[model samples]
Target: MASQAMKITLERIALFQFTPTHCAQARAMLGWSVEELSREAGVSVEAIERFEAKREVLDVTRLTLAYRFEAEGLVFFPGFAPGRGMNVKGSTPNPMARADFAMVE
Candidate 1:
């Protein structure tokens, strides 16, 4: 049977783009295997493999992975930010929390 496509949600969207490096690093720090991550994130192991291999996957897959990591206290930062990377929670304050988003006129 053909598998169902992943669904997109607001949680999948974040201020920073989640990369394969982040996924690997977060998994390492959490001491989680791909299967463990799949169980936690409710994502497929194949999807996690594709993502960690730096292969293109669905947007929802990437987002879901990021969301799962973030929920586990992993912070993801984009490149170009000085001294920024996946960090454990409480190392630095969250710079772009959703509540911080405000419409500017």
Candidate 2:
């Protein structure tokens, strides 16, 4: 039962998708550069650049990048709504955390 529950949780998490815009916004919000993100995500700088430019990346690469950003306190929202967006995970003084924004492209 526990294993099944874990599988279900993982499946739900796998459904979340982040766009190129989201990645850029989150990086900007955290004041991180592409090189920084690449190092943290364990992906090549070229991969990050390509993903940002094309908004498409391998599923595993996307997951790695997303998790890396999330680990840095950026929370990604995966829906098409005004309130669906990224923000810092906690109540920080960062202005971006207080903004309700989304990137659709």
Candidate 3:
């Protein structure tokens, strides 16, 4: 059952992928600045800025951001409908202690 769910989640991720809006929203929810996210994700600030500005950026860069944020307890949903967005699982991220998020769609 869990594997099935993971498969569906992977499909959804592949279909819709990640967006700049999602990145900005997740970063805002986590109270992280571009510089903070750059340091955390090991992505350059210019790349982060370009991505957030909806400009062209490398797929690996975006994937790196998504993966890093996911590790920090953020779950991303890809769609325009209600409930199709990001949410922090378990609890909000804390600098002192990390939260856990499940990869299920």
Candidate 4:
């Protein structure tokens, strides 16, 4: 079985793929037109059109798509490593932590 995060990742990818009703759903949920989403997400309206029609998309755009949905949960896995998990907005911690250093007198 895949890890939970991996499973969620696959599920989101699927939702993004077969039947991108999610985009339409997102439009309805967010009250934005496809053109608006495309602009905010820095993608093309034609690309959004194609995504709605064909469910296929560029790897690079996947992150933007999640942002457009306000689906921060979907952003976690792809943008982050397995153990570290997601980062809350406005909080900047080093992804890789280190033990605090001390000086011996």
- Maximum-TM-score candidate: 3
| Model 4 RMSD in angstroms | 13.6
- Reference-based lDDT, residue 17, model 4: 47
Q: Tens-digit lDDT track for model 4 on 9-95?
A: 854674444235555665655568987876666667877787778666664454355444543222223233212215433111221
Off by over 4 Å in 1: 1-16, 80-105
List, residue by residue over 1-105, the lDDT tens digit for candidate 3: 999798557645733556788889878878899999988777789988999899987655766677666667666666631122355432223322312221111
In model 3, how large is the Cα lDDT of residue 32? 94
lDDT of 1 at 12: 41
Q: Sort by lDDT, best first: what order? A: 3, 1, 2, 4
C-alpha lDDT of residue 84 in model 4: 21
Cand. 3 TM to true fold: 0.62
**Alpha-carbon error at 63 in model 2, in Å?**
0.5
Better of 2 and 3 by TM-score: 3
Instruction: Give per-model TM-scores.
Output: 0.61, 0.61, 0.62, 0.48
lDDT of 1 by residue, 1-105 (tens): 122222223334342557787788788888899999877776789888988898877765666667667666666666622222455543213322423122100
lDDT of 3: 0.64
Q: Predictions ranked by TM-score, top down? A: 3, 1, 2, 4
Q: Cα deviation of 58 in candidate 3 (Å)? A: 0.8
Task: Give the higher-TM-score candidate: 1 or 3.
Answer: 3
Total clashing pairs for each candidate: 0, 0, 0, 0
Candidate 4 error regions (>4 Å): 1-19, 71-105
